[model samples]
Target: MKKIVISISDEQYEKMDAHIKKGSALNLNNETFSGYGLILNNAEGGFSWLEVDMYTNLDLGDVNWSIEES
Candidate 1:
């Protein structure tokens, strides 16, 4: 699997947190982890899903993720 290190803003994090909690309350085990959840990538934006397992670690290399605030 491709290692995608997404850089999201604090606001985005809060939104995601709430969504995950709601999923848990609804017995959505496939959509929530201990606390973190999965944000899928799709053509038109994506939805939430549970993170099953990480395939690999990301190597930032020369790319800076700090500037990607969204």
Candidate 2:
């Protein structure tokens, strides 16, 4: 599998932070996995999602998923 990362400006980070403090969620990115899960391909995995939370501390082991905001 291939790995990827994204970076945002300080202003954008601050904006997202404020929005989260007010009680909101942000969907940074998404990708679909095998709907059949392990029943299908051995290398295939089930569906997964990555999210950005209020504190801006997040990480998902698979697919090298991680995000940071300050």
Candidate 3:
């Protein structure tokens, strides 16, 4: 499988954090997860080719994921 790397800026993370804190009183929904959740969702969509390959019965390897800090 191809690799997808997602990176968010410090400012972006802070904004996400603030949004989460502000909504802490409410139930979480899509809007509450538009940060990394949306990013990972889009990445999965971008990697939909793997699913397409499975539709054709291709012997694709297992999906793998990991987080790294730099």
Candidate 4:
């Protein structure tokens, strides 16, 4: 399988987080996680991805993710 690396904004991340949580709440939904979810689930820590979402399937590596140190 071809690896897909996506760089999204904070706003987008929040959206994905909501979606993943909704899917997990169901009784039968074991087929809605991304490949990288094995390394980390959004609910367990941070960030989220959907195996069924179009955004997760896209190749969005052009976006620049800024890191603001506090």
What is every candidate's alpha-carbon RMSD to the true fold? 11.6, 14.9, 13.2, 11.7
Model 4 TM: 0.36
- Candidates arranged by TM-score, highest first: 1, 4, 3, 2
lDDT of each: 0.41, 0.37, 0.38, 0.43
lDDT of 2 at 44: 40
Better of 1 and 4 by TM-score: 1
How far off is residue 52 in model 2, in Å? 7.8
Enumerate residue pairs that collide in model 2.
Answer: none
Clashes of each: 0, 0, 0, 0
The residue-by-residue lDDT of candidate 4 on 22-63, one tens digit each, is 655542455554332422224433445433343243322224
Candidate 1's C-alpha runs over 4 A off are 28-70
Model 1's lDDT to the true fold? 0.41
In the range 1-70, model 1's lDDT, one tens digit per residue, is: 3455556556555655565556556555465344333534333334322222122222222221222323
Model 1, residue pairs in steric clash = none
Model 3, 19-53: lDDT tens digits are 55545434354334322233232244444212111
Per-residue lDDT value at 35 in model 2:
19
Worst 10 residues of 3 by lDDT: 48-57
Q: After superposition, how far is residue 18 of candidate 1 from its true place, in Å?
A: 0.3
RMSD of 2: 14.9
Candidate 2 lDDT for residue 18:
63
lDDT per residue (tens digit) for residues 1-39 in model 2: 443454445654565456554443222322322111111
Instruction: Compute each candidate's TM-score over C-alphas.
Output: 0.39, 0.30, 0.33, 0.36
Total clashing pairs in model 2: 0
